[model samples]
Target: MGTGNNRTITKTRRKIRDVDQIKADLLCARHLEQFKDSKRPEDLPGLGQNYCIECAKWFDTETTLKAHKRGKPHKRRVKQLREEPEPDPRRIPGAQTTSQSIGQCYDTQSAHVAHMEVDT
Candidate 1:
C-alpha cells in the first residue's frame, strides 16, 4: 500500500512538471515566433529594447520598462497569466475496480424474515 501510494505521488509530480514545461515552452515559442516575424532594423514594433523577459515584449525606455518588469504587480500578473488550467484528474486513465454483486436471494431465512419485517 505504501509503495503504491509513493508511486502515485511520483507519477503525479512528473505529470505536473511535464505540463508546466509544455506551458513554458509554448509561451517561449510564441514570443520567439512573433519576434522572428516582426523584427525590423530602424523601428521595432514594441519599442526597440530586447525582448522584455517579463512582459515578453520589446520596450523603448529602459528605466521605466525595467521598473515595470521589476514591479511586484507585473510579476504577479505574469505569474497568473502563465498558469495553465489544471488537467482534470478524473479524466486521467487509471485502473477500475470491479463492483461486487449482491444476489437478489437472501443469504438465509432469518435474514429474509428480518428484512421483510423492517420493510413492513
Candidate 2:
C-alpha cells in the first residue's frame, strides 16, 4: 500500500510538471509572436505617448507600457471592447449627454475603474 501511494504521488507530480511545461511553452510562443509583431509601429493613433486607447491609460515609460499590455485588467478590457464597443451616452435612451455623465458611464465599468484607480 505504501509503495502504491508513493507511485500515485509521483505520477501526479509528473503530470503537474508536464502541464506546467506545456503552459510555459505556450506562453513562450505567445511572447515570441507578440515580439515579432511589435517591431512595426502600431497603426493606432497616439503612438509615442504611451497611451493605451483601449483602457484610456497613459504609462510613464515603454517598459511600463509593455508590462501593462500583459496585465489582466488591460487584457480583460481589450477583450471586452473587442466583443462590444463602448456605448455612446448620448445615443443611449434616458442617458445624460453631459461630460460628467459620460465619464460616470466609463467609471461604472469594472475594468475602467480598476485602471483608473491604479493610475491615481
Candidate 3:
C-alpha cells in the first residue's frame, strides 16, 4: 500500500488528525439526528453522506452502509460509544463537576470553586 492513500483509510483510523472531529460532530444536533434515519447526498460522498456515526466511517453507497451496520465492527463501535460517559454540556470552565445529572440546573462552577477553596 502507498504511504499516503486516504481513500482506503477510515476517519477514526487516520493517523494525521485525532478523533476531535468526531467529538465536535457529536455536539451538533444534525449529527445525532442522522442516526435515527439517514439522508444521503445526491452527488455521492458529499460531506460524508453515508457516514457511520459511532465508527466515524464513510461509505460510497447506502447498500454498503446498511451492510456495515449489520457487521461486527459497527456493532462494536456502537457498544464502545455507549460505554463512554456522556460529557456535560453545562460543564464549567477550569472546574471539575461535582454534581452530575441532578434533574435540575445545578451550578458546577460554584461547587468546583468551593471544593478548590477547601483544598487550598
The lDDT per prediction is 0.50, 0.49, 0.56
Candidates arranged by lDDT, highest first: 3, 1, 2
> What lDDT tens digits, residue by residue, belong to model 2 across residues 19-108?
223333333555334433554445433443575545644466778888989999878866755453456555756543332221222222
Candidate 1 stretches greater than 4 Å from native: 1-34, 45-47, 81-84, 89-92, 95-120
Q: What TM-score would every model get versus the actual structure?
A: 0.37, 0.31, 0.42
lDDT of 3: 0.56
Give the per-residue lDDT of model 1 (tens digit) for 1-120. 344567778876554223333334344565345544666735663446555554445556677677878888668756865675774677535644332232222233354321221110
Better by TM-score, candidate 2 or 1: 1
Worst 10 residues of 2 by lDDT: 99-108
* 35-77: candidate 3 lDDT, tens digit per residue: 3345344533634667776676678878999999999987876
Model 3, C-alpha of 60: deviation from truth (Å)? 0.8
| 1 or 3, greater by lDDT | 3
Residue-level lDDT for 109 in candidate 3: 48
- Which residue pairs in model 1 clash with each other? none
lDDT head-to-head 2 vs 3, winner: 3
Which one wins by TM-score: 2 or 3?
Answer: 3
